[model samples]
Target: MPQPPADAPALAADYFQGYSVVGLLAALGVLFVAVAFGAGRLLRPVAPTPEKLMTYECGVDPVGEGWAHTQVRYYVYAFLYVIFAVDSIFLFPWATVFAAPGYGATTLVEMFVFLGFLTVGLLYAYKKGVLEWT
Candidate 1:
């Protein structure tokens, strides 16, 4: 193995110093959370009541079963919403890149390809009646 230069020790020390700062910050964050939780526990009242002990759900008492069946259509709707939301996010970056010289045609074609995939998925969902409210 080749011997490192005299400056190598200084470089290594500086590299480790950066990591030491990060470690110190992480330690301080943990200590702060610990102190806050400890203070809350020591200062808070310990009175227990039936109302406080019972499980609460959206200001209403939990009914018969903890597990409730949800329709699969709700999940499908959420998935479709996420797909279009992400597509809209991609459009911002695509539009910026498309405005740059020499990238107009390339970006346009790529965006169309992306939109085509989204269109296909939407069409498939429509054909399956996933878009129907009935």
Candidate 2:
């Protein structure tokens, strides 16, 4: 291996200078946020009325319970959507890589394995009647 130049210390300082600049900028950002929050807290009025303290929902008065039961089917649908969305994302990159030389057979097999897993999950969901709308 080639020996580093005699000016290695200078190079190290130059590298650290970049980090120091970044650190300074980060500190400035935090300081700015702190100053803004402090100014807002100091300048804002402290008067608290019943209406102001209560939760406001548009212009309409509050209705029944705030918490409502959400159906598990909605969550299942969302999970399936996310799975397919991620599958599409992976597909695009895999297509590009699959077209590259020498990666054809390997990527093809790997992709089949991936699709197999998805298919198994889909079949499992179907068996569980999760796909039923009723």
Candidate 3:
């Protein structure tokens, strides 16, 4: 049960000073950002034109209204892609772990169980005709 020396208080104070320094740096960063934005607002020219206000896409002049109906199939395809992509990512790590020494039979069974769930989901999507592209 040895007590800390008198210098312990100075060491603790220095530790807290590090946080104070970080806080000061963060405050200065915010101040600089605000000043930059304010200066740009005050010094920049304000000019509004029809072309500048129009929505531009791929360097082509937009011909139709900005608000337009989109096909739901594209969204469904993107969602299915995300789901399978994430599942494949998890499979890689699981495969690596399954190959390790202590994780032989138990890991194999568990992995099959996980794949069964993924298979069920894929089958459900297939049954609903979500996998078809037309």
Candidate 4:
């Protein structure tokens, strides 16, 4: 059998061996970001005005109140897009596992049930006319 590790040197070697490169890389990343930010601060002009403080949109001057009304339909459409995107993320892994020998009928049924929920959601969105471009 091989000899057991020593108290100090072996432990230090084991610990540093795993983390020394990672620590060095982390330190280098911090140093790089710090240098870049410091350089920017040193080189940039220090001009502050009311126009700079105001929010700029498409080069248009400010009009009326800062707050504007937003359509709820747009939010619903975005939320549905997110739901489908998340659904696709899960489906890719499931499709990979599905081809494996051990998982057959059970995986098929589960996937269909998962798809059924998505189908219902899609139908609901269709009924609400959320998919319309006009």
Q: What's the CA RMSD for each of the models?
A: 2.2, 3.1, 4.4, 4.3
Please give each candidate's TM-score.
0.81, 0.75, 0.66, 0.68
Could you say which candidate leads in lDDT?
2
Compared with the true structure, model 4 gives a TM-score of 0.68
Question: What value does the lDDT take at residue 122 in candidate 4?
Answer: 94
lDDT of 1 by residue, 61-108 (tens): 888988889899999999999989988999999989999999999999
- Alpha-carbon local distance difference test for all models: 0.95, 0.96, 0.91, 0.90
> 126, model 1: CA deviation in Å?
2.2
Candidate 4: tens digits of C-alpha lDDT, residues 1-134: 97765687878888898798999999999999999999999999999999998889889988888899988889988898899899999888898889999997878999999999999989988988888877
What would the TM-score be for candidate 2 when compared with the true structure?
0.75
* Candidates 1 and 4, the one with greater lDDT: 1
Worst 10 residues of 3 by lDDT: 64-73
- Model 1 superposed RMSD (Cα): 2.2
Q: Output the better candidate (2/3) by TM-score.
A: 2
Write out the backbone clash pairs for model 3: none
Look at candidate 3 and tell me the lDDT of residue 42: 100
Can you tell me which runs of candidate 2 are displaced by over 4 Å?
1-15
